[model samples]
Target: MEGYETGAGTARQAVKMDMPADQPQTPIDEVIRTAYDNIGLERLETVRALVPRVGMGGLSPVLLNKIRPLFKHTHLVKDEYLFQQDDEVDFVYFPENSVISEFQMLADGRTIEVAVTGNESAVGISAVWSTSSAVNCAQVCVGGDAYRIEKDVLERELTYSRPLQRWLHDQINAYIKQISQKVICNTHHAVEERFCTWLLMLQDRSRKNKFNLTQEYIAGVLGVYRPSVTCMAKSLREKNAIDYVRGQIFITDRSKLRKMCCSCYSELPPRRVF
Candidate 1:
């Protein structure tokens, strides 16, 4: 083999590095171009519709433009993980006709939902204060599209926009308040009452009288056994509070449903409060 002698009297063989030609091409400017395309005039109309729902509609034209460039449209599918617990938070999402659920995993492999975010709110709002990770598992509870912005870009803009900062802070406070109240509700409320409360919350967020949700998923969200959830569903059905067929739940009797729920549902702040 052909070799070269070094000054140290060591011989080294010549080598040729082989690289794959089919590797994906990712140019620096490609991201910028894609973002521009995703936020085009047609999409800007969608953003205009969402900004108000997420409580960012009142931003000044200059600020809105600055922030708008940071956002890219996103589609969130059902049962998809936006981010897992303790995962790095690279982006914060603003739901537009979407619902995201936050879940806390227990030591015994069980999980319970701590909160839900919908069209009128933002997901991963805690990213603004945290370092770069999430505290809970975030998933798409309902399939829909949204807008997302990098944490760094949003943080940079937050430092310069007083209105945006204040609005986000208010939203964070509201979220914390919701989680705290759920703690008390789960501790003191009955399973049937809690079940009703959960349905009402889902109804409010989806803005629909009916949605597809199985009893097993409801059990997981409620942090109860499957049998318990089944019993509660049967009870609700018997009381004419709701009609559960297969995986779909229909709120046929809204008044009865509300009456069955604990006061926690009404006591919580409305979705648009922030």
Candidate 2:
């Protein structure tokens, strides 16, 4: 896999170099070059990190070609609010490079994240199940490209595709598990365990062992004070599990962190995603 050459012929060239005359070629041949391949993957790296199947939907050519335009080019600003709690819930978003956070707002004006949306799946589910609004508010965590579709459109077409429906259900199930476990971890676990759990979850969608984060936001997600988060992060770092510096977190040893985390990491909330 030195390169991403997608050739199925005697000879062909990649985006970096063309093949000689006796070669059979396909349009994808050149695009699979190492440099070009990375550009493609980085574009949706966030999405793939979560679902791992965004590029494999394999929709029929007719259907894909028709809907492809809808997603091929879309944009959202960094830190933009996509929607809020109790909105009409008429659409869901498939973010390409962005990270979307779903939170529940408490009466005290604090919010707790229920799920995070990145690649391979839609962010908000309001339109998916025809619910009015389940998200307190969703914001762009990474601020990148996003694909959006009306809820009605996906629902109508979903009836004809079992695979797509199944994928959607899987995403929902993951969301519920995230929210439930986070709630229990927040309520019953010690701060250190909660910090480790948060790191474990974030590790799933980050591009590197080092991540962009802050204790202030972690506190918001956990519905706790900033000092509490700072204390836990410090303890984890002291244990050689992770390090925090200038709004960034570096995971030193994943296995150690997993071991240090609580049992909620093992016991997830039971809910039907679909």
* Model 2 whole-model lDDT (C-alpha atoms): 0.58
Question: For residues 122-224, what per-residue lDDT tens digits would candidate 2 score against the true structure?
Answer: 6765458565565468876655666677777778667887766766777777677767776777788887786676665544433335555666677767777
Query: Candidate 1 — what's its lDDT?
Result: 0.68
Residue 80 lDDT in candidate 2: 77
Over 221-261, each residue of candidate 1 has an lDDT whose tens digit, in order, gives 88998878777766766666666566666665555666788
Tell me, by TM-score, which candidate is best.
Answer: 1
Superposed Cα deviation of residue 151, candidate 2 (Å)? 2.5
- Give me the candidate number with maximum lDDT: 1
List where candidate 2 sits over 4 angstroms from the true fold: 1-69, 72-78, 129-131, 143-146, 266-274
Q: Once model 1 is optimally superposed onto the true structure by TM-score, how far is the C-alpha of residue 222 displaced, in angstroms? A: 0.5
Q: Cα lDDT of all candidates, in order?
A: 0.68, 0.58
